[model samples]
Target: MALDLEGYLIDVERARGLEDIQTLILHLRDQYGVDHIVYHWVSSDGEQYGCGTYSPEWAQRYVDKDYLRVDPVVIGCFQRFHPVDWRKLDWSSKAARAFQAEARDYGVGRQGFSIPVRGPNGQFALLTVSHDCDDEAWDAFTLAHQRELILIAHYFNLKALELEHARAPEPIKSLSPREVDTLTFLAMGYSRGQVADMLSISEHTLRAYIESARFKLNAANTTHAITRAITEGLIVVGGTSRAADGGWPGRRTPS
Candidate 1:
């Protein structure tokens, strides 16, 4: 089914608290005809918060078993900056395999897809949809709704952050002009040396600018700084870099 992103955004903006997000998850789960829809994120400070449509029993079991340590989805998604299919994640370890079987026993799903989200202040989150379906059906569903799901993931994260700071949003300091240029060229697919040359600066000067921008954006690193810049409208690359890669060039896999 086609998602109404405009309508969804309106509803998300109307959300008063986490409870409202829980309701939204349920609605989206049903609308997508998926068994579960989850949004989980960890703050830079290691604080975790989330909303999802999983059964209470499974949720409790997951916590009691400390499955977070063994869950490949969480482990893999933490290292990635793009949407991923469950099959693509490594589930070969004995502990991981056991966790997978238990999850299925609890009706977690036979198939899943997750979108990794990175936000300001180095926050990391995931939006996942899981269902009990064969490979072909799952592939078809993902192809049909992937873009909408990505939009939904970001919108959901925005609302979650808003509610997390309901009193007053932590103000985002503006990037300096040098910082802006550094990020723009990087996002435009320029190598650091190439960007330094284009900006008429040495790599050392460019590195300094990026580190400053990273601090301002509260990003973890250079790639994160570029992506955060794009998402926050701090800089506009206009796909000059994305076109070359056939995708966003700033995607990261954390070490």
Candidate 2:
């Protein structure tokens, strides 16, 4: 049966705490007919947190076995800027294969899709849904639900960040204009050199600006910087171009 994902999202938005988030995940798992749904986050200080539908025994086993060391999902997703399918990640190592087998035994499922979300202040998160299915069936499922899943991933990440921000010790700073310019072009899939030329700046200067922005935003890379900028409203998507006014080309405000 098809899931009422929209209703679930509304419920998720009303969640008050981590326990509530976990309850929502359990609902999603059953609703989507997936083996598990997991959302894991890491903050700037290296603090980790998560909410998921995985069994307590499996969760404990994962920690006890130090599966993070060999888990391809964690490693692969860390390096990727886009969503990834489980089949695309390398499971070539014996340790990785063993870990996968153990996960399967614990009912974590053989098929999975993961979205990597990077937020301001060195926050990194992953939203994953896994199930047991044939390759063809899984392909169809992912294709059909890809857009919804991406939206859901961002929604979940945003909600988690909001909660974190509410508990933060200090107020977060807004991105500078130069930082927003760099991120805007990057999000539109522009090459660094192209972006530099569009902004009438040298590539070296552009690199400096990007690095500064990354540092200020506590982003791990350019992609993360852009994602954070877009998520935090530092750069507007499909808005008027500030770049056209000789400020910096391609920089638009959100409408």
> For this target, which candidate reaches the highest TM-score against the unseen true structure?
1
Query: Residue 66: error of model 2 in Å?
Result: 2.8
Q: Candidate 2: what lDDT?
A: 0.80
Write down the RMSD of all candidates, one decimal each. 15.1, 14.8
* Cα lDDT for residue 164, candidate 2: 82
Tens digits of per-residue lDDT, candidate 1, 1-255, equal 656779987898898988998999999988888999999877665557688987788888887787777889988988888889999999999999999998899888999999999898687899999999999999999998899889889988998888878756677788776787789889889899999999899999988999899999999989998888787666767744323332334444111
Q: Which ten residues in a row have the lowest lDDT in candidate 2?
A: 240-249
Name model 2 segments beyond 4 Å from true: 44-46, 171-255
> How well does candidate 1 score on lDDT at residue 211?
89
lDDT of 2 by residue, 53-142 (tens): 888898788777766668899889877869899999999999999899989999889899999888776678899999999999999988
Clashes of 1: 1
